[model samples]
Target: MRPSTQIKPISLLKTQTAQVIRRVCEDREPLIITQNGEAKAVILDIQSYEDQQDTVALLKILALGSRQIAAGEVKPAGEVFERLRKLER
Candidate 1:
C-alpha cells in the first residue's frame, strides 16, 4: 500500500502542499511530487524514512550471511562444542 497520495506541479505546491503535508504527517503517507509532467521526488514522514533505513540495514546483514554461507564459512553446532572443549583443556 502507498504511504502517500500524489501531489502535482510545484506551482500548486504552495497552496496544496501544507494540506497534503499535513495529511501525510498525520497519517504517515508520502507525497509524490512531479515536475514537467514527470515523476520528480517523494516527501516522506520521518518515521517512514527511518523504518526504510532499518529495513535496508537488515537486508544488508542477510546478504552478508548468505555470502558467507556460499563461501563455505559456516560451521556445525557440534563443532562449536569441540572448540570449547579444546579451549577448556
Candidate 2:
C-alpha cells in the first residue's frame, strides 16, 4: 500500500515556502509540487528520504542475492553451518 501523497501547486510553494516546508517536515509525508496541473517535484523530509535510501539499498542487496542463487553460486546451507559449528568448538 502506498502512503497518502499531498499535492500542492507551484504557486503555493512560491507564496508559502516556509509553511510548506514546515508542514512537510512535521508530517513526514511527501509533498508533490505541480506545475501547470502536472506533477513536477517532490518535497520530502530528511529522515524519510534517508529511510527510503536505506530501503532501496536493502532491496538492491536482496536482488543481488536472488541473482546469485539463480546463477548457481550459492553455498550449501548445511556445509556453511558445519563450518560455523566447527569455529564455535
Candidate 3:
C-alpha cells in the first residue's frame, strides 16, 4: 500500500479515470483501486506489465530446466554443441 494519493476508491476511479490513468503511467507505479476499503484491482504501466510477463516466462523456462535436471532427462553439453555445430555447416 502507498500513501492515500496512490490508492483510490472505486467511486473516485469511475469519476476520475483519465487522471488516475495518467498518474499511474507518468509515475510508472501501480495504482491500487479499492472497493469497500478492500483492494480490488491494479493499474500498471504498459512497459512494467510487459517486463513482468517476460520475467515470469523466463522463470517458467528455468523451472522446466531444473525439473529436467532433477529427473536426469538431460544431455551432455558437448554433445548438444556438437549437434548445433553440425547443423550450422
Model 2 misplacement above 4 A:
1-5, 77-89
Compared with the true structure, what per-residue lDDT tens digits does model 1 show for residues 1-89?
Answer: 45234555666666676877777688786777778877788788889999999999999999999999999999997999999999999
Expressed as tens digits, the lDDT of each residue in 1-89 for candidate 3 is 36677788999889988988888889988888899999999889999899999999999999999999999999999999999999999
Worst 10 residues of 3 by lDDT: 1-10
TM-score: the better of candidates 1 and 2: 2
State the lDDT of candidate 2 residue by residue for 8-42, as single tens digits.
89999999999999999998989999999999999
lDDT of 1 at 41: 81
| Order of quality (lDDT) | 2, 3, 1
Q: List clashing residue pairs in candidate 2.
A: none
Query: What TM-score does prediction 2 earn?
Result: 0.80
Which candidate wins on TM-score? 3
> How does each model score on lDDT?
0.80, 0.92, 0.91
Model 2 lDDT, residue 25, Cα: 96
Instruction: Give lDDT for model 1.
Output: 0.80
TM-score of each: 0.72, 0.80, 0.88
Q: Model 1 Cα displacement at 48 (Å)?
A: 0.5
What is the descending TM-score order?
3, 2, 1
